[model samples]
Target: MKSVNQIAVAVAVVGISVSSGFVAAQTKAPAVKSSTATQAKSSTMLKATMADVLKASQASDWRSLNPENTLYLEMDKGRVVIELAPEFAPKNVANIKALVKEGYFDGLAMIRSHDNYVAQWGDASEKREFKTAAKKVEGEFTIKYQKDTEFTRLPDADGYAPQVGHANSFAAARDPKTQTTWLTHCYGAIGVARGNETDSGNGSSLYAVTGHAPRNLDRNITVVGRVMYGIELLSSLPRGTGALGFYEKAEERTPIKTVRLAADVPEAERSKLEVFRTNTTSFKALVEAQRNRGGDWYKFAANHIELCNVPIPVRVVK
Candidate 1:
């Protein structure tokens, strides 16, 4: 994990919501949108509801930030690409970045695996019940304000925060009442762990999402961002037989050779990856197309997409 230097900022935006039944019913639409590219026009007529219209409205109003701030984790199986949310958790992001460049995770192992929850990796301290050996460098866990943060907000209602949106390129929660905001624990999410205190665990020990929506972790821990690609690698790892998914033997643990930042890698060595821009006409149409409105196939269109489930299609161009 790498900590980005950027900071988090709260936005005055409403939650985003889409119904499931209607969207699920409307499955086959002809005129569709592109998942991975910018489509010129959508041929499908979205029988969009008033709410879908609003959420799509914010798509045009999306706030895209620098990809240089993106963090890339290198595992033996493959590189797990993660975009860090500095705006929501600056110190956490920074600490991760520093650790990555320093090769702190060069020889660590993933010891914990909780099904439908998180897959964690760090100093696999066996015979030790909860040790903080990874905390060589202590950092502030949370922040009050972040300047120049480009927060792309969701219009759907969230069960977690006053508002929900994308910060540091992941689904997020914001609360004006407390002047606070943080990352939401959605699938493919990456988070920092703390023991008892709010800032207990530094960026040294971290975890990634593997299963369904784990909203319980929201606001309780620091969720950085969602996995942009190669989630199959992390989510598919074998489950541990012991409690908390702790491997019973040293051989059972997954070794982590190193973690990296995309900025640090050479262009040739770096993964030639392109993430579909969030605020695109094609994406909006794709979302609408996926919902299946104005079609016979779909009995009803959900007219909604989850922050975690939102298909952020990634591809390597030929």
Candidate 2:
């Protein structure tokens, strides 16, 4: 049986042999060389090598996961990095921006966590009509594909779709039947809170994944972004037993002291971070090296990696 760490967490990768030596956390990382376009286009997908990947990953295959699309939920535990789906759901993203700007999530509570389902957080008030009107924003599934969203489809069999891969640093699956792409809710994944019809969230509520993959929630809720660095702060929280896993009383709830955008924070307090870009040779090489792990620790290599199981590593550079 897989242990809790294996069962509960999913992470990303970087170029070549770095997988075994990779460090992912809210702390610091040694300098990382970015990927370049020259290496990225040298050969077609199948012919690429680990060195080719690292060389391409030199300067071009790196992009700052945009701050405007980012949210930093500061809690007593730590920071949760959420990337918003602004293109897919503009209204929902805008509402979330407003709520963040207004400090709506500050002092609110994380009220629900259903194991094997989702760990949710938001205003737990019983005032349904009032809260409904405020957060009941519309949902938009027609997302304009951004130039930054360069997806590299995976070749393995997946329960969710014909092909599974990464785009914008999130686990993604594309339906050949419909050509639709959406974020897969892997562990530590973040999503907007909403009701049955969609467009029910005012961005006042949110959730983070804590258990098994819940692919059913993919297009149902507006997945703003995901916990890029500090997912442990949420997933390790004690589970609740009240309705929808809500703590029985206010006293048991975890308080969010503040939810601020990195852009809003002072430059000194911001997280100095970079994500190895998707579809680049370095990232491809990084994933491939781990996919087989020809390194010292393994007597044999798997030569296979699950879509959700792979981690896009994050580091704080000095």
Candidate 3:
């Protein structure tokens, strides 16, 4: 019998054809010319560090998350906040919201905690019925690329996709030839787990990536949303002993208190939070700052950064 991890890896092998133009655009290095004018310009510009950029940011640089699109996952340890990306997976998000509203995940427990992979939770016994939610949802691995979508393009080249950027506060990738855009498998990303069929998994069985960015999973699964806070609660869980990191016994699972939509929670009990706007100039400056690290602590500044390495800052409103 094949292990669950092997099956997942096998399912992720979807063929993607990269256009020649796309490859040429990303691989070509910029022409470097040593000129007196360039030297003078470089000397005059004072580069601001990421901290300095944040400190100087205006209120417009940040936006409050919509209550309707937010989720509060409560456990014995604490609450984990998640922001749903309805723009990316509308049907899946709606299904997930329905499942959440019907108290489908209240009694469920964390069944799998894979080392350097993901932490998954759901009805491990497969006994729970989908009262109001769909048993299967069409996989939304990628959506038709909309021209009006908010995509702040990252200059860095990625091996997985032709173009990588931030879309609606989520790390994303696109292929112009295919005219498709998909959310990436960055840390804290929430994905629906399935068996063999692409549409087999619904929102009932959800997992959060807690380790390295599994870019291989991109365009292979439906990424519903991402955890905005309390990722440590999932990452800190004991690694499962069984194959594919599933708990061998029911007693080993951690119980879930409830998973409620932020809008459903009372105003007094809600967590007011804000995330840095990626479409703003301040975000560009922040990215530039990170691309070239400042301060004397670093001996060498890695002038490049991976798409998943970019930090999406979030803050609690006091």
Candidate 4:
């Protein structure tokens, strides 16, 4: 009789052979029966893979991006789609929306592209003017943690905050002791650039994170939103040569054709996309699948996932 360890090895070997079609001589082993039967009868049933979880998700598991809260940054190459987080930075988002409607960023330039850091754009000139009245929004680095907030906590350790989770589809951190919650500086996170004063950022200068999660920036800067799609457009730009990745020569700055709110654009011109709702049962299953990769290719599961490693799925509305 084979030991338990030996049985597991035999099962793994059989699974690989069956998946790789090494037993083609067995009349192409029944596709469904061979795979499902073996796994189901095993003492330890394999967890569903990420692909399997996503495939089993229902239509209700996803939510459409609200056009009123979406922004499109148009450049020569393509448009970068951004989703605003009103729940976190309401005043900043409101000011940004007003600026977009007033055509404040119609001809501004992207003045900075730092390699593995950030891609920032705004009025680089000192004589820049706002077309509309820009409000002085106080720095909204963190908000009062409300119990009713829709937060889906993750079962993982984070070096930055005591507890990490997803709030309104945005990566976030919460401290129950202080009763405060703040957005994390995950990749693609958009923050308003400020000067010496905390309230200096008036929805004019904005930067998107292109590198790893700089969690230290949380609670230090006002993060307004995140780039939902077309991050490649900004990430692929040439890094500037001057200090802090600013373009040394004025001509090197990339021209921004326009920045418009999706709601302001014509219906046919708007981009249609949907994001997976993080508060759904399917999302929990998806998270579990990622924590422990269970597939024929994986010999051992890590049984762990980081806050930044979690991928929020987005798909075009067909």
Candidate 5:
């Protein structure tokens, strides 16, 4: 009979032989055609790039600006188009519409152009008049959230609000617990300038954010709308020398030839522009494309996007 050590060595050899036989069988096995077919399917259905998503967008994916809610700021260089957010700031919008109809901002100059901050335009004269409306409308900083309100939420972490999203076409923030929603101060955001008093801003003086998003002003000030086009017309203006970017010399100010509501203008004279609707399947795809950056140029995907960083595409209807 074999000794205990000899028997153990024989058992080990047998185990090694069995393992080698199993490995050989696996190596000789035929590959599955299903894997290659799956790969081909995946390649065919690869994620779309931002450009591809936009190219695939349909006519219904875009929305036309309501003429009643659009404002055309005519200057020497060109027209600065703005889209008002009546859903967010109804009181301010009402006041602004009245002012625009009354020609309150027709000759008023763009008084301030604080670099990387805001470009404000209104009557600089001490004795400015609001011939069409009241001097003080209740502050419409935030409105009660309505369940019926159409909101398209972004899937990104925000340092500012509990929830960040877009309502209508405006960047907005909401607090579900409190049922409150307000427009954020994003690039090209148009806000009413107010004094220390809360109700002071009656839509007379307006400012457009030309730089980084100042989200701190979201619930503190009333945001009327956003610049839909010709942002460079305001952003590229010379920085004011005086404090708070007030032009020291009157001649330095850019004159506002006229600020008219698109509804008041002739159909032929109005700007033919369309904005991508936020609440659409194409928009969701567009947002995903932006978040991932599926193009070959990007070495790595970001996977996340900020609310303000998302581009709300606006194109002149061709």
Candidate 6:
């Protein structure tokens, strides 16, 4: 089994290498230093690594995760902290929270760990009764694009959506032509798994992206949130052997200890975490640094970054 640190490095490499649309299809341009870009004008960003950008960030550049909007998936390995984006999928978030309160996922098992895809967890028998959560929920694949939406759009081009950006700290995109906005299937995204019918996903069966950015699923499924911490715990699980990566035997499955709302957990037991806000100058600088990685190792800069390639950083607070 890989340690949490190893899994993070491996997953990050997968995210950067395999995510579609991360690199442009056009012919490779001549290598240019990152200093040539307009956004690189800031000395802090000019030829500076992402670490430098983060190190120079101010306290105002980060936002704390709300206890009510956080979920902790406890397992034998460790806890996976998820930051729910109720702003994008309010109904689903509400239902999931209700299910958590009812202890719906207390003793369930992770049924699937699809290689280069997702790690899913829920009642495999499909016989569990819902105490409060609805069995079906209308998909919130896309919402009406509001002018006041908190989005930090990437200037690069994307083949999947008209405009790719980050909204409410989640990777998202919007189409002004249709006035619609939806979350993308980025690495670490938590989504509801449904059957043939769109409304079948009721937050009972949830999955987190463990591999590359499955951008093809965007708007086709409901992405409720992202892993704010401990994604490695899910991504490092052994790949399932059955179809769609479902474990064939009960013994092969990893048991889920419990799923609890951070608000419900004791204050001392909760994670002291804060996420780097997307709508900040420091984050923008970080994006630029990623677009054109600094240091002496590279001869050229990519000069382009996709929605999933740009990482959303989280830090533990003292």
Off by over 4 Å in 6: 1-46
Model 6: colliding residue pairs: none
Better of 2 and 4 by TM-score: 4
Sorting all predicted structures by lDDT, with the top scorer first, yields: 6, 3, 5, 4, 2, 1
TM-score of model number 5: 0.85
Best-matching candidate per TM-score: 6
lDDT of 6 by residue, 1-318 (tens): 234344244335224321222355576455464654534344433476766676687988878899999999999998989989888899999999999999999999999999989999999999999988899999999888678878899989999999998876778999999999888988899999999899999999999998888899999999999888878788889999999999999999899999999999999999887777888888888888888776533445678888888877776775
| Model 1 lowest lDDT segment of ten | 5-14
Q: Residue by residue across 184-301, what tens digits does model 2's lDDT show?
A: 7777666777676766666677788877777777767666667766666677677788777777888877888888888888878776666667676667776775566532233345
Full candidate order by TM-score, most accurate first: 6, 3, 5, 4, 2, 1
How high is each candidate's TM-score? Answer: 0.70, 0.76, 0.85, 0.84, 0.85, 0.87
lDDT of 1 by residue, 1-318 (tens): 011110100110111123323334355455344542223223443355323443344333333334566666667797777777676666677777777767777778887788877788877662222232345333333345444554555655666566766543456666766656667777777888668777577677788878777887776777766676666667778998899887789898888877778788776776554444545554555445554444333343455655655544443432
> Model 5 over residues 55-165: C-alpha lDDT tens digits?
678989888999999999999999999999998889889999999999888888999999879999998884777787889887888889879888899999799999998
- List, residue by residue over 1-318, the lDDT tens digit for candidate 3: 234333222212211111112224555555453465344334213477665776687889888788999999899998888899998999999999999999999989999999999999999989998898999999999999778878999999999999999987788899999989989998889998987899998989999998888889999999988887777788889999999999999999999999999999999998766777889899898788767655322334577878887877765665
lDDT of 5 at 254: 96
Clashes of each: 25, 22, 0, 0, 0, 0
* Model 1 residue 141 lDDT score: 32
Q: Which ten residues in a row have the lowest lDDT in candidate 5?
A: 11-20
